[model samples]
Target: MNPHTISDDKIQAAVALLQAGETVAFPTETVYGLGADASNPLAVQKIFEIKGRPIYHPLIVHIAAASQLSVWAQSIPDDAWRLAAAFWPGPLTLILQRSSQVPNEVTGGQDTVGLRVPDHPVATSLLRAFGGGIAAPSANRFGQVSPTTAQHVHDKLGVMVGMILDGGPCHIGVESTIVSLVHGDAVLLRPGRLSVEAIEDTLNKKILLTQPISTKVRASGMLNSHYAPATPIEIQPADELWIRAHQLANLGYKVAVLNLSDHKKCASSAAITRFQMPLQADDYGRELYASLHRIDHANFDRILAEALPATPEWVAINDRVRRAAQGTTNETRILVRTENR
Candidate 1:
């Protein structure tokens, strides 16, 4: 299949499945999404069951155009319109007050819904053809690495999805930047390729960080232990990367080192494999998940990733890496090394 073209016939078939209360895995600029008719409660439930995602966690509804925002959300704020005009048909998501027309299932029973118009031809084509909102989340298992390619979706979801629309590799290679307008002030719920600075400059006002303790709205990707790979990842500081890799390798564990810095000093052993990652933030974000998918399948016992920079430009990358390493611990890493040995 040519990744560049999505035939009209394919769009119609996907639309049929969705209208009949079924799910389809389709690509977006950020990632492949497991989408279902946003208006169909039963079909939305299937997404939760298939991905083992908690029902209380919300999903983002994809619309064909910015004009359709009113269909899913009500009491839309002026800031919503401003941001949409700037970032719609791209990688930004706006959370607004839900409309009566929106199914409770789509919003996780909350009064707010997450909406975005993906900047991808296949997603837009499918959305325009479907004629309504499509509630979607990253097309992978809950708390696992997101699928960036059609084959990744098939490998993770298989026949569970009624149809898989392959739109090639996601260009952004991360989820959408999610900002909430339902509150009195704009709050960033999740970070993606779209930087927070960009959003603030567009709104001309400071966006608040998410206050999990006080915030009632539950947005997707809010959990600490998300986007994890099957192989537990340990984020090592740049200075200690080689030391940690050698430590694990000496203990007889197969360690995959995700290196984004110091490319000239390539290190490898029978138990250690090194992968050179993109140096720039944009390129790194685009390649992050695809690299995770490859390393996850390569029979590695653990992943030791070099810590990324702490600057604003690297915020999204840092967030994802932090979450991916959230569940990993020193004890667990040592245990895996010893067990493998």
Candidate 2:
């Protein structure tokens, strides 16, 4: 199937923007990425300056096809190709030794680079039109919620980015599954919409981790306090969320909720913003960032978010929530569901 389904004019415009050392926020199968020309070291530096991202944290180089992977990476192992063959042009990212063609700024002074071929049509079209790797990361600020829609990017960044390709919402709400093969073992660095079990099944080997491999290079989204909003996020159990939010509201707090549970409530108070989320994991993931972006600007005292079930399907959602709730010290009291306890 042809992935260049985006209009030729839009692709050409984005290509022009990128080649001029300006950044463009383009859609991918996973999330919207702030894209810059990977070959230009100064262009890559713009990504860091605009997002306030640390130079030590590298960006993922997105390419149009698997054939172009050799241009940016060197010493590619057969296992990496095997995994890429199975999951490439999709959400799986393979880390390999960086080539001289890829500028040092894109790799954050590391010898390895993160490479992926996004399955999204507009993204592939942009990459093919540009004819080179685009160093892209989530379009949000250094560690805030990611942008799933072009509007989210514009709302957060304003005119900071040269342009944003409106490719609709991202299919997968989170980032890609990062598998590092540079240090002699297939190490699973990050678990995303693609489950670790599925990648292990495809590679047909038990993958190791960063601790066991002892790699020092930092991949994207590895920070402990990331994806957080300007407001604090408190992760509360589903059952107690209503009571806790009510209590806080009674104390003059503006409570905004993102709930996926069937437990329903009709709040009369305007201070509490209740949003019903999708029941399924993928549907929920697809709208996660957009929802957070909307609620974060509502000026709530704190977002009392209800927690999701801990399961393999919810790994990406949980990871984002964990990072979102980092540094928030509000612990809700677990009250027993009894008439008189």
Candidate 3:
């Protein structure tokens, strides 16, 4: 079946489904979200069941606007307001103290809740119509490639979801930058399109970044090996990436290259596929998920991604790359061996 387009009627139908304690997939600036009513325990349970996500990993609550933040959070810190003013309706998620009104299932039995006001029109409209926060995560199976388009959701959930609100491709293809505010200070839990420097500038206070490895994490996508494709992925320097790609190709393994530059490189074997990401940081972040989604389905034996720049600007993108390539059990090690010519 063709993917359904976004319309008021479709939005109303999705809202009705949520109100009736059902699951739906809706578009957001970051990616499509598999959402359920945050206040309803049963509806929230469906989200976890559908994605096969662990109940220990909490979900983010999407609201219509900043005005609704207090409805879900017990107390909104001053920094949260500043961050919301600077990044809300965009791709930043603020984790705050959860109010009693919020269901435990939505917060994964934690005292804190992650909240965001998506920039996508369809998401805002649906949230407004529902008149409450909606718990949503990337519309894909747990630990799999995230959905950047309506077809991605349909391909994953099929008719299991009551509705799909298509809003074209996502503007920011990766998940939001999640900041936990439970400690009265803004802590950067996850990085995304918004950089750490950007968040610091808004709050005029130094932000503490969580280590890559954390044992006390409460949200999904925080683990080392997540958002991975079926094929194993390896990261290497640009100078060595092509040689490694060709080496893997010659080894009788289907290999694909994800380049972060404009110019395309020559491949010795036709079996090696090359894909270039946008030269700009923002565009690259927006296309990261879609690119991975494609490579995951290309029947490649493994994916060899070129290491991105170590500059501060590329921090978020690199974080996602490392996580995506890391898989569920392996580290994203940099291969430094020379090609045997």
Candidate 4:
């Protein structure tokens, strides 16, 4: 089966499963989403049980088109419409006040709901056939690396999903940019495949970089530790990555390096492994999760990554990487440096 093509029968099968209140994992431009009927509280609860996701963290409701927006969300702001018109059918998610039609299960008991029209043939086909909202998050266990391919979904979710729609590898390979319009201002709740500049360009106004404290809304991917791999991860400066990786390897610990520099410059040693990363931000985003998924299963003692630049273009990548590396400490670095001295 082609990654870009999904048979109508397959799509209809997924739609049927969703309509029956069974979870269906389908491809989106960003990542595969574990989808459930948004109107069914019991069905939505399955998503939480399947992913082990906390009930407090809301799921983004995937719709077939922008016209269905009012069906799930109310008090739709003008900026939400503008952003939807500009970035919908793509990787931008708009957060708006929940409509009475929306169940609290989908919104995590919050008054606001996050919604997006994903730009993938399989996802769009299933949504159109179902003709309703499907609340979905990354089709992986909570706090783990998100799945980017059907195989990743199957491996991570396995028999838990009623069906898997193999649309191919995710094109964008990251979550959508979540912008909250519930607060009357375009607040960026999460950085994702879509850039902040693009949203501002469409709205012709600067979006708030940080969500205000008083009006804070709980949205997906807002946690400090998320998208993490099982192996502990540490990030080091490009200037120091080699040294630190070498130190850990010399310390008799197996280490893997997510080298962001030129591959040839970072030589792998007997105890050290290196995976070269893409230089451009877009390419990097597409490979980040898949690479982490690969690295996570390779049985390394620790994963060390070269730090990315803190530029506007790399904001989304940095955000994901930083969150993924949360709870990682510098104890290894300290041990290595102290031993070398």
> What are the per-residue Cα lDDT tens digits for candidate 2 across 46-90?
999989999989999999888988998999998888887888799
What would the TM-scores of all predictions be?
0.95, 0.91, 0.92, 0.95
> Each candidate: what lDDT?
0.89, 0.83, 0.82, 0.87
Scored by lDDT, the top model is 1
Q: Score residue 252 of candidate 3 by CA lDDT.
A: 93
Off by over 4 Å in 4: 1-4, 263-265, 327-341
Give lDDT tens digits, candidate 3, residues 1-341: 33445677888889899999999898898889999988899999999899999998899999989988888887688888888888878889988888889888888888988999999878888998999889999888988888989988898889888788888898888888988888765778888888888888888888877633442447657887788777778887777887887777777988878876554446436778888778877888888778777876778887887777777767787877777766733543455233310
Between prediction 3 and prediction 4, which has the larger lDDT? Answer: 4
Indicate whether candidate 2 or candidate 3 has the larger lDDT.
2
lDDT of 4 by residue, 1-341 (tens): 46468888888888888888999999999999999999999999999999999888899999999999988888898898999898889999889999998888888889999999999988888998999999999999998888999999998889999998888889888888999998888999899978899999999999998889999999999898888887778877777888888778888988988888785766887899888889999999999989888877778888887888777878888878777888455453311122111
Model 3: lDDT of residue 237: 77
